[model samples]
Target: MAVASSDGEYEDDPESYHSGDSEEYQMDHRPWLERTAVKRDIQDLYTVKGLYNPSLGLYRYRVVDRLGEGTFSSVYLAYDSLHNLHNNVYWLPEETKSPVGNLCVETGHQVALKKILVTSSPERVENELSILENLRGCRNVSPLVTAFRDDDQVIIVLPFHACDDFRYFYRLMDPPKIRAYMTCLLRALKDIHARGIIHRDVKPANFLFDYESGHGVLVDFGLAERYQSPREATCQHEPATRSHLHGQRCRTDDTLTVEQAVYDARKRSRAGEGKVGFRQEDARPAVKTNRAGTRGFRAPEVLFKCPDQTVAIDVWSAGVILLSILSHKFPVFNSSDDVEALMEIAALFGRNSMQRCAMLHNRTFISNVPTLDEPPESLASLILRLNPHLYTPHQPDPTPEEALEHILAVDCALDLCAKLLHVDSTRRITAAQALRHRFLGNAEDDGPDEQLDPTEGKCGLLHRWVDGQRG
Candidate 1:
């Protein structure tokens, strides 16, 4: 690591050192060798310090602080010393433009340094890098600055963004603010999903939102993978179509309904159909699939271990975030395992919906929970139940006009939430569709409203919404 002087100049040679304003020079007036020895010791001290606040990529990046850490990688807040010294900004690639007309601009000197641990396989690291490179300049998506590897440790540099913690402000946010947050997130997903990438992990922590600026950046591609089509999985020779691959439904879609699926599952259980003896062991191996994501945010398909996971999983995770905002809860689903997670979903969506969801993926869902057997609770009812303050008129209550606006906003948000969190992955709203939903202020037939600003360019509507909420 290189050391800098008090004036912030890199000292490459001790011979060139000049104590222009040092009282130490007058006190000691030591010989050149003695002075050099002292300077060398100081440099050694800095080198030791660098072990903790390490520089990377041949001392181009200087660590400022540790941002976060996880099982696979650690992130550091770093200063791009090279860019800072050169007074240059990192520009997006010419071909890397947002497909949905969102803005993409140059990044500043500060960056986040993601250090992938040796525990991760080389293939996984390569895949993550590839996805980031492909997603450059996508709206609201974190673009890659650069990446390098020194031996077994790999470091990826990304533009650093300042944002509030989701837990701190979720309860305080109004419906309009939630709209801005989801708009940014869904825009990011739209861009990534367009490229056939699935962000397996989509949680609040991965999205950095600065309420003051009303801008958010979606980060972390460690668990991201390319979407594998169900058609390709079963029949490789068939050419893939956009509709068939993007949100492919299971074969049971035509035959199964929530009511019928639930009834059949219960009837089979009562008749002991497909029940196997405890001693009847088979030599078949258990089916396995990638089920990578945060505990509460994983979609039903992921929990059901569906082999044909698609980009819909990301939308489901985003829905969970929206659910959190509406219900005034940071984590609406708190489960230790997949089974518990499914039960939590069933509790809200009803076992009937869960059964239909299971059948969609060629699986059976049977639950003994009496409460879940009841009809699914409407999202509007659930939101009001969890957050009664939204509906109750209290002190400082708004006028009739204001109250109506609030109700309408909440209704649109709940409708979008329902669409995004649909039990069937194939039927869930796509990121592009979510952006155009009335909740995000882009209804297909409706003309531009006050939410849009003509001068803000193609994404003016979204930009205005964000700007309007800025503190």
Candidate 2:
């Protein structure tokens, strides 16, 4: 199984290839194999060779254009022939509380394939596949078409999709298009939550357009996990500033800036900070530590005391995305680490940490939170520190309907973000609650016009691992 060139020329198998050990998480997707077997017949004719890298094994792919880039993956335009790679999709079994989106399935059509770079453990890549496999039927969520050990490189196949990705969409979208896209994306989120999972990574880049031409597709579940269990949240890898930059590592030769630290802290928060869980809830388990997340999107809880929060953290990130699209600017809270992220959040929303507030209330708000990295008074000057231009007051406060619509979206999203990204898991908004928001409700009844078969079984293997406890 090596796919040759566009010339349709078959090439010899590369003699020397690395033997990749099957990851335990990947093994967990074994259940999917059984369930997916029924899908082979329908998808057999859809197979094709993938465009990127060490070709080998039972993999269908195609060569297309480049889609996007990131620290860990390279997405491209390609075709997945077998499995109706572009035309069909599936969701969880009816019994599950979660709602998954339509998987990418093209009947000899183009699709987007994200090739993850091999920088971390092989298991990490496997974990992403395992997660995607479980979420196969999740509408808008990218499906894991197939995973193969391509010599030294590991590859996962997905359907070709449109470029209305949120990150870049802002650069090109019109008002009507943005609204329509947001409506579709939010609907996807609603369906996703119905299945008991939390899309931990909900940013512009991760979210692409839906199959409905300009519509959006909710993607990038690498950081996503089910909220049914306690998760180990941390800030070890997190930087400590509020600038929109990558989090800084302690070992780096370059000095870490305050901005970088904030960015890293926010990311760490997404790594499982601001979380809480019960023993029986075997979905996500817990331990507090450090983790870094995309800047601006890092929630207040995670930034201040990561590895100590839960699903609310994702809400914060979602709000940032919503705001960015509405404002057409990079998210305002972009920070380099946790401390600064928290400071920015506090500045915007008023300094009201559940942990600190508990002291005044003499009752539990957020009983278990990470130690604060800054002082209480830092909140007042938080906005001022970040704002170097002083106050350039707008006399009329521009109210373009499109901008106002975005403002409406952001304000609504912010309330949800604040609730879901709360420091205390007890106070956070659950997935069920989020689905009911006005913004999320924008596209509720309007399912995709395309008739996609619902998913087959429960895609909870990875959810059980990342969101909850392992056996």
Candidate 3:
């Protein structure tokens, strides 16, 4: 539990801003001269800081401090001053409202006001808002409170989720806690994927988790987009059906399947006809598609420049998070660029598998590293090497049954990890399927009791603030 703050400037005490002696209270019911003075005070605090000008929705929200700043937007912690006056009703466009109306906002509700920068295109801003509206009421997904625009500066209001930093508890989380974390994340992904949405960015930073209460919310849909299949082209090859890229066990004799053998024979025949090399006279254009995602967490297909990327790419990124938890590493793949990222993946899955993966996208992969020629290491071996304490008992003398149970739990987690990290996009586990995985099937029973609503009272915020100090 941690109260959301930026640079220790976010004030959690509502009285500090709403006291009877303060200008805000006097402005509510006072003489014209006094009200004008209060308005000037508000303008000096908000407009002068460049958070929100008086012409925007400044009358409804009072800016406190900045929460975070990203490439496309800056988030500020603010209080909804009009929520109490409106009887806890949330203001939304008529077409955007549900049958029961938008989610209610309490009096003095804390919210994260995300101001989209002018550099972002109008289409991009609209797309992000449209996606958020469609995903309203989805469990574990942050709900949009409201949005306002004034010329180029736009503010999208979202609930301020109080949670601990991932870096503070990633290594400290036990197996059961990890299960709960993945379960919440996958549930959010399942809801969005069912609607054909692809969360291009699915890293830990985008997922806020209150580890003590076992609650989490997926936020920041800026990079999200609907999946659209590309039209079939003559130059594009059909996806490989029996590639070793999925990490399936091979036969002891190293015999190839009939379909693979026939495919290889056809390739050799084409090579004999001098059709393998590049043609100077060819007129075909290069394939290009959206490649918007964070590095290291990107899927192999994304690195391979696959034109028909799908929701499976998000699943791969989730697998990277799982790998980090298992290995006690924040970033399992710390590559600087796409080329280096692909090379890092090759070092784990090996070069032959990488080549077959490239064939899926009608591309070729070449690596000069000698070690990549060998078979890939098993996930269990990698995890054990990184975190041997997972299998070893901490006490001086532990019972046999205790050790066996620990080993079994680790095995279950590794199995799920293997399916998630599968290189073939078609074979990668879906978020829905992952929810049923053995490792996370008992997540509800394993985690802490369900937490109270974060916006109920000052208790939630105070509790989180204490947790933050302790952390």
**Best candidate according to TM-score:** 1
Against the true structure, whose lDDT is highest? 1
| lDDT of model 1 at position 341 | 95
Give the per-residue lDDT of model 3 (tens digit) for 256-301: 3433644664576445754444468988777677789998899988
Kindly list the per-residue Cα lDDT of model 1 for residues 270-331, writing each as its tens digit.
67675523227777567699999999999998898877777788999999999998888878
Please state every model's RMSD to the true fold in angstroms. 11.7, 15.7, 13.8
Alpha-carbon shift of residue 193 in model 3 (angstroms): 0.2
By lDDT rank, best first, the candidates go: 1, 3, 2
**Model 1 lDDT-worst window of ten:** 231-240
C-alpha lDDT score of every prediction, in listed order: 0.69, 0.47, 0.67
**Candidate 1: where are CA atoms >4 Å away?**
1-58, 84-108, 230-241, 244-265, 271-284, 392-397, 443-471
TM-score of 1: 0.74
Q: Give RMSD (Å) of candidate 2 vs. truth.
A: 15.7
Q: Please list all clashing residue pairs in model 1, or write none if there are none.
A: none
**Residue lDDT tens for model 2, 75-175:** 65554445342234332222221222332444234556666665756766766676676665555665666666644455566655546434544645544
Error (Å) of candidate 2 at residue 196 is 4.2
As a whole number from 0 to 100, the lDDT of residue 223 in candidate 1 is 96
